[model samples]
Target: MTPLLELRGLGVRYKGAVAPALEGVDLDLAAGERLAIIGESGSGKSTLARAVAELLPQTVIQQGTVAWPGLDQKARNGRDIGFVFQDPASSLDPVMPVGDQVAEVAHANLDMDWRAARRLAVELLDRVRLPEPALLAQAYPHQLSGGQKQRVAIAAAIVARPRLLIADEATSALDTIVQAEIMALISALVAEDGMALLFVSHDIALAANLADRVAVFRHGRLVEQAATAELVSQPRTDYSRALLAAHLGLHA
Candidate 1:
């Protein structure tokens, strides 16, 4: 079967930066597969996510193709992709009711009517395990906890039911327990919908636990990519080994 998403010779360069944010990056995300991009801060994992989501600014120069299964060309405006940003609070609108926001995504992409969209929003909230979907729907962004906000963000992203979901450092802001819940939620959603997941995070251990495949990034390049067990058990690159060592030390 054709991969749900494919990146070929992908590169991104921002204005005023001498070095490209990403270079010669390549990836294939099959349907229903969970892939994680793991690296340190400024390692370009988020850059790659933004590029795939088409969230990067127009000023940034990009080369190569980010192809989807049905589209003749790379998708723009997130038609075939959905993105959950690292910061949920920043990603959501403070003024709008959470329900309306989710409804808007569904309305825009799925062509759902207002009533149907609102109903779908409530269902989405429930799907993400939010309590009191009706009450939460009326609440503003400030009313929700960090984890709740992230759940809402994920719900909004899933409302469109896009083929690929790009979660960029999605659980980084939540506490460990909440992070685990969010990861489990995402994993469940992926399984239920058979959607491809691109999970970008700096936490190697977490990624190893969550992803089917893990790609290690260093200075804008993918240094290693393999099955999660293989990569964690026997990392081929020195950088990969160091990352695993640091992760082990942190949890020790």
Candidate 2:
């Protein structure tokens, strides 16, 4: 089957940046497959995610292709792709009621009326395991905890039921316990909906635990890509080994 997403010799450079954020990077994610993009800050993993979602700023000079052979029509941002940002605070509207924020996606992308969209939004809030879906729906971002805000963000993301979910460091801002909960929620939702997952993270351990495959990136380039077990057990590059070592040391 055609891959859900494909990138070939992709390069992205900011208008006046000294170097490209991403260069000559080629990668693929299959439908319903979970793939992690592993890298530290400025390694360009997030750039790759934005490029896939076409969320990059217009000032950036982009080269090469981001194609979806699996999609018959042009892929849309909210309808074909669901993105959960690292910081839910910035991603969500502080003034809008959380429920309507989610309902808006369904209203816009899925073309549902307000009543149905809101009803579906409540169901989604429940699906994401939020407390008191009906009551909490009226709350604003400031009213929710970090974990709860993240859960609301997740509800908004999947409300339209996009085929691909690009979680750009989605769990990074939460505490360890909350991070695990979010990860479990993401994993369960992906499995249930069969949505392709692009889990971008700096944590190799989290990647190993959640991804079927891991693609290691460094200095804006893809260093290596392999099955999760293979990459974890026998990393081909020194950088990969160092990352694994760091994770081991952290847990040790």
| Top candidate when judged by TM-score against the true structure | 2
Q: lDDT for model 1, on a 0 to 1 scale?
A: 0.89
Question: For residues 171-216, what per-residue lDDT tens digits would candidate 2 score against the true structure?
Answer: 9999999999999999999999999999999999999999999999
* Residue 81 displacement (Å), model 2: 0.3
In model 1, pairs of residues that clash are: none
The reply for model 2, stretches above 4 Å from the true place, is 250-252
Q: Which 10 consecutive positions of candidate 2 have the poorest summed lDDT?
A: 243-252
Where model 1 places Cα greater than 4 Å from the true spot, the runs are: 70-79, 250-252
Cα error, residue 88 of model 1, in Å, equals: 0.4
